[model samples]
Target: MSHLSPRLMRAMDVAAHAHRDHRRKGNRVPYISHLFGVMYLASRVTDDEDVLIACLLHDTLEDVPQEYSEGRMREEFGDRVTGIVLGVTKDDSLRDWRTRNEAYLRHLAHEAGDESVLVSCADKLHNLKSILADHEVLGDGLWSRFNAGKEQQQWWYAAVHKVTSRRLPQIGLNGEFGELVRVLQRL
Candidate 1:
């Protein structure tokens, strides 16, 4: 935080406020904590300010209402950041879980680029980490938070790992995505 640039610092503020009332499913922790994990993991993959900012605000589009959509994100951040947030956001209109997950994967495969995948890579990593950690304690009860069950959740993670790993074969970082893939594959 003390080392972050002004642009990224502002993003942190926006994410904290936007998710002020949201809590994590696993332990009911503040949602901003998850965003922070994603931001930190994304930072490991790249120092690009846009990706880091997007990571912090990635859930904003998915969790916040239309009035607080990317338009506000654009005003607070910029088009680049707004676009990155939008890129990672799934269309909630698709009520069916599998359909929404599949469509999101397809969208990432076709439309999302390396930067988008970078944010996604960190996102998946942190999410998988939470799922595993909570599952260790809460066991199967943790799956209740997600629409997809254990098998389906595993499938999505594996699929996203394949696409994102192929898109970003070599991040030259500490292998966060690779570690995530390995960990998720073992599950």
Candidate 2:
């Protein structure tokens, strides 16, 4: 048996349907792998069920279409899980990549709470690891798949690392975040 909590299994089911149409940028990989990676990392750092469930659903509100509203999510997953998803959700109406990312980093710095950062850190760590892996094979071509180039991508990850790192010490999960930051820096 896989031993997943019933709540987590339900979260994964919802996230799978929500992200069903999406694919990773550089390859044909399903976006669900990214979600699972975030969940795996977050589960490693903390046993909090809400955190784990949030990790699975983290990208749903941001990436999926209007299939699931925040209210609907709250109805399905409760306040804490929905709140984490909303906290990590970006303002999508903003036009450009840099502008959106800058706004998100700003929000992380000024508005987001520690629980929000905890979930966001796992998502960023998984993304940076994918970027590093794709960079190995795709080289400069990999940057073309994303909204920004290598330098801009690196900047965004570094920025998230900075904001997320400060929050991690308080949560006592600083080492994992630190290691992710170091790997991101090296990449």
Predicted candidate 2 versus true structure: per-residue lDDT over 51-162, tens digit per residue: 8888888877887748778888889889988888888989999989999989988888788877789888888878877887887887778778877877787778878888
Instruction: Give candidate 2's TM-score.
Output: 0.90
Q: Write the residue-wise lDDT of candidate 1 on 1-187 in tens digits.
A: 3378888888889889888888897467998999999988777657788889999989888888552676778887888887887888899999898999899999888898667888887888788888888878887787788767878888888888888877787864326556765665676
Please, what is the whole-model Cα lDDT of each candidate in the order they appear? 0.81, 0.80
- Model 1 residue runs over 4 Å out of place are 172-182
Worst 10 residues of 2 by lDDT: 168-177
Per-model clash counts, in order, read 0, 0
